[model samples]
Target chain A: MESIRKLSFQTSQFLSFVSKNQILLMSLLFVSMIFFSLLAITFGSYGLSIVDFLLGKTSDIQNTVLTEIRLPRVILSGLAGASLGISGAALQGLFRNPLADPGLIGVSAGAALGATLMIVLGGDIFSQYSLGVFFIPLAAIAGSSLVILMLYFMTKGFGYEGVTYMLLVGIAINAIAGVGIGILTYISSDSELRSLTFWTMGSFGGVTWPLLIPVILIIALAIIIMIPYSRQLDLLQLGEPEAFRLGVDVQKLKYTIILTCAASVGASVALSGMIGFVGLIVPHLTRLLGGVNHNYVLPGSALMGAALMIIADLIARIIIQPAELPIGLITSAIGSPFFLWLIFKIKKL
Target chain B: MTISAKSISLELGGKKILDNISMDVRPGEILSIIGPNGAGKTSLLNVLSGNIKSHNGNVSYNNTPLESISIQERAYIRSVMSQFQSIAFDYSVEDILQMGWLDHSHKDIKEDLSAFQNRVIKECDMENLIHQKFNTLSGGEQRRVHFARTLLQLWQPANTKDQNYLLLDEPFSNLDLVHKVKMMESIKAKASSGTGILMILHDLNLAYSFSNKILLLKNGRVIEQGETKKMLSARLLARAYETFISIDENPINIRYY
Candidate 1:
């Protein structure tokens, strides 16, 4: 009798939670994201504080570590997480498939192949140029654009049959990229091999001020493009022709989704290599927490993703003192198990 | 003015789906396209709805070419319900239903979707489905919910020159008898409120009962068209369906046995 009463109370609480306005729910997520970001900045080997930075209490080296390393990594991780999360939400709605992730479009793998080729082949040659930091990212962008171009041609500007063709072409591209990466790995030197391994495992250690700017611009552009189309994405869940009848320019929507997703996912992979499961897990969490309306899901997923990625990065930093674990490892390790739990919970529902 | 199609022809996968079809649906009239299987009734409906753009002839909406109108503008003017609308993820029934309000900018509808909620839910028997996840609903329940959503898309203003249209394909397929009657009544009420209705129906009895106008199609061609009472002639329906159809008088019944 007590247990039933407790269950009923919890049910009422959940009902109240879901009934809250969507904007209020999203504001909660936004506040949480800010809270996590501020908290993450205070962590790491060289301890820093917002209070200390504000009061000018930190020494020069400490300030340098805070400014040059900690700040960039946290912001970049947040940006990359937001990009992946929103892109994942948009792609899932566009594909009308729950399993569609940022990587499903072949951008990340294509970006990986590009970065790997640049690292393996353009060693000291790019060091002579002033844009040494920009070379690998540039190559990654080029590679992703190549895949995007191919997809555009194959689908004929993303017409009615475009979604299916995109998935199939994405598979082929992933396979080809895997082979290319494998071949590059075999040819790489010991130091190159180590860097390649760490990069693929994923980290925010290499994040810097210069590299942050383009990523910021690109991801911001992607988010701006995605949010307004949230309703169109929701309509797409009704099916293509229904969306068309409802006045969504289906072809234009398809185009916007693929391109924005590619730009942001490509930039994220270029900034931080192969962060798995954040894309898949973040949007699913937002949909589960808030309702599945893309209006809430898109922005909520973005905020939740940024918050989770920062918290995960903090855990990765302090899990083993001095030696940090890969952010990708932490995300997948926690994410996959949580995903299973969600699936079981869904089954129960 | 009418939503007119002029000599529209569509060929898909080397098979003729609709051949030189011409028809129109006007505001406040329910036009039912009825035929046997493989009669291209759905094909004709698709062409008229502006979904099949590669068709041979022209489609005009209220005297303007359908292609000239932007999709966003057209969405405000018409609502379509296809044969199937399978959602990919778990959305509450409220979420899916609220999607119909995407293009609703009517000044009279001062509030959000709640204004029509009571009527829509009651008519479609969706009171229990309010907070439920859409994917978990039974097939018939899902159909009812979709019907509710389709009804919510078009509103009944007192008197408006600019009319909205409701296009459906086999909307009654998964509905039970009582629910079908209720849904048809809701559709008729929408029509009475000056909304045009164009639908493809497999059930001749329902078509004959509900529609003001009817088109009988056979093998990508119209076998007969015009007033529902006259166009549903037993001999004409027999030729269209290629079956032994009989109509008994006194109570007006049509049977193809």
Candidate 2:
């Protein structure tokens, strides 16, 4: 009887603590993300286990596979997912719309168009300049920045009324970028076409530690810069005018959010082709489980995004064994249905 | 100290929204701006609050140009409660009220305001809805919540001598009789504590009862302005609104058919 009472008391205490402290909940989420990353790193075609590697029982081939190939893939997936998730949360809060995502404003489409152009055109013209590996990511960043600039200029006149126009413009821009990609696809060589197709579909197969490090740094810096704006973002949820009246420099906040989201999403897209749904769904999930305060939502989204991507990548790897499926396919398959459910739940509310 | 707007005119899309409007609000006084629909009362309020830039005029606060004061500094001196209160996210009522404390210095004012916030919450009758989502509240409840938030923004400790102002646009809209009286009492208390209030109220009776001064606006111009008892005559109100109005002298109220 005494043991049972003590156990119930501990259970109630744990529940109360979670209810009281959001940072504690975020830490728990981070631990789960670490667990998912470990689990993801353990699986692959080679049947490598983290336990064996830690115990010093793995062979040289296993070490190479774990350290060089699988580890980078896992880390890249986590980083890309985190960037998308945090960017989504930031954009949603900036726009004061729950449905706002990075893709909603054409950042991902712009990056994809840039990568497609590089894959189709850069190899011939830029190869002589020896811009081999650095060319594509640079082009991707340039393209995303151009879109962000266009969005800024297009929405400049409308004040708070510009949010709806911004979304409409985003759709138009996405269509134009899609047509551009189609033209590039039609003009490309066979190998270039194959790579472009894979790029649009999204994958982590080509990630290497050397290529991943700089992109990781860029995304990490953007997210770190975003952390201090949580209170400002919360104020913005009251609407633009209200936020301004509360002493928030709404214009400065807007520019900062746009630039940071562009950098993070642009870098993630360059690193891993076009991972979809993570940006759209991870933020919603975070807000659903937690509250809408960006203070918790931003960090919660980062951890949740990392976990979801790690799990999705693991499924993509193991579902077909030696032949891998695209991570985007797995994410959309999981995310779209969940998104519908969320819509229905919100309607009921 | 006073906030004075001189010859303020605003044109939007070639239509004059506010034309050469001038007004002054002093500390510890309640000034009510009243007019019919599209009379530019809200536009005038916006211009006075520095939310809108007038095409031709100057607004000064305490003998200094209003535009020269930084937005963060202005936020401490004045708080505005707009007619439209939109909260996109599902923040609780308490969370919404806490946003008003954003500009408070982390000194004695903030430390003492924990109790002040509670008092405003109770005064606004939002004790039951403290934890409720802001979006889920009824329209009247939402208005009270915003009123509480504005009160918190203008809240100062008992010993502080710095003056502040409240600019409310249609604050009593959608409120029932009881809440309207409660909100008026709260505003009176704030004014008595030396916070100037400039509000655009549609209810002429409430304005007559509560306000010290009145400004009647029509067609983007002020029709009459003076002490409430002197300026709120039936002839001035009927001429401004272009309708017949009967005055009840003993109780001091106007009736519009």
Candidate 3:
């Protein structure tokens, strides 16, 4: 009885300590994300292992496969996941609704439409301007900015009833953007059509080191700028007037969050297509495990998002063995069920 | 030395919401603004709290224009709790209360729940509800939680030099009678400690009993503004509210027929 009592007391103490130190928990989660990323880099069709690479026993072909092909792919997936997760968490906080996500709000659809347009129609425009290869991401950013701007105006017009109207406007804009993409698909040549399909489904198979660099830079910049707004976002959970009276510059904060989310989601979609669910579910999971404080939810979502995406990409790569599945298929397959479960849980509460 | 609004006016969608209203909220006093529905009491509070910009004239805090002060700097001097406190997230009651300390530099949530915050929480009878999700609470409980949150914002420990302000809109609307008296007593105690409070109230008796100054608004205009004893006569209140209100003096009771 004495031994059992001692063990129980120690367990309670440990649980309390862990609950008190959220930064430590977040750090551990980030380390796990890094581990999973490295593990993901080792799991392509080629039989390369980290053990062999570390022991200096890797063949030249194996080394090239690991470093040149799989490394950038893994890094891109991680960045895309992190960006989506953080943006989703931020947007959810801004709207004060858990259902808000980058994909659901039409930002992803807008970016996909922009990239598709660039793929199908920008050849002549690029050649005329001598814009070598930067047109796709630039167009994606422009498209996202336009959609976010429209959302801002629509919400502003609705005044105090903005949240519900914002969601409706997002749905309408998403439907319209989908129609535009359909039109682009109809006019594209065979090769452009194939790439557009692949882009819409979202695959990291096409990522290379050169293309990953600028995409990583843009996403990194956006996420870095977004972390500081977590406190203001927390305040905003109390509604705009309350937040403003508590000394938040609500207009400025809203504009900054919208622009940052646009940049991050636009760049991620440009690089990896419209991978869904990472933004939606990862933040929910973070809040469930770590609480609703954005200081924890934001960084926790980034880490968990990176880990989940890396694992999803790994599954996408190996599930078909030489024939890769789209990363979006795996994420949605997992995400949709989790979302339903969340609804039921909230209802139960 | 006080928040002064000079000839403030607001028009929304070509409709006048507030028309040339001027008032003063002084230190160490409870000033109540009482009016009927659509009398623009809430809108006037918005203008004074800097949530809404007035179309004409200016609002100044301690002799400086309110627009010139940064939001972060203004947070140290004033905290407002509006009538509507609809929080969408399932944050714990403790989490909602801790958000009051957002402007403070304390990063530790446990340590930031200072002695004053605890006393306010205890005073509001929120000790039993602190661990529960805020959304799960009933309407009256939620109001008390938010009341405690607003109080926590201006609560300073062992320091009474700063002249802070609390702007509350219909704080006693959803509270029960017992809690309402408790809340009024707490507000009086805070005012006695040098914190200025401006509140909008529908209960005429409570306003008359607690407020040092009273402003009566009608059709977006001030009907009367003076000491509560002078401005709260039966004739003026009846005329402002368009109802027959009788005031009883010794114990301070009001009845509307």
Name the best candidate (by DockQ): 1
CA error at residue B120 for candidate 2, angstroms: 1.0
Model 3 chain B worst lDDT window (10 residues): B102-111
Clashes of each: 0, 0, 0
lDDT of 2 at B239: 94
lDDT of 3 by residue, A248-328 (tens): 778888888888889888888887888877889999888877788887888788888888899989988898998888898
Error of 3 at A9 (Å): 38
Could you tell me how far off, in angstroms, the CA of residue B196 lies in candidate 1 after the best superposition? 2.0
Put down candidate 3 lDDT per residue, B6-50, tens digits, no spaces: 999999899899999989999999999999999999999989888
TM-score of each predicted structure versus truth: 0.88, 0.89, 0.90
Clashing pairs in 3: none
CAPRI category for model 1: acceptable
TM-score of 2: 0.89
The A-chain TM-scores of all the candidates are 0.82, 0.85, 0.87
- lDDT string for model 1 (A2-115, tens) is 111011111122122134577787889889888888888998876788888889998898788888899999998898789889988887787676656656567678888887
Per-residue CA lDDT of model 2 for A250-324, tens digit only, reads 788888888888888888888787776788799888888878888788888989998888888888888898889
Q: What is the number of residue pairs that collide in model 3?
A: 0
Lowest-sum lDDT 10-residue window in model 1 chain A: A1-10
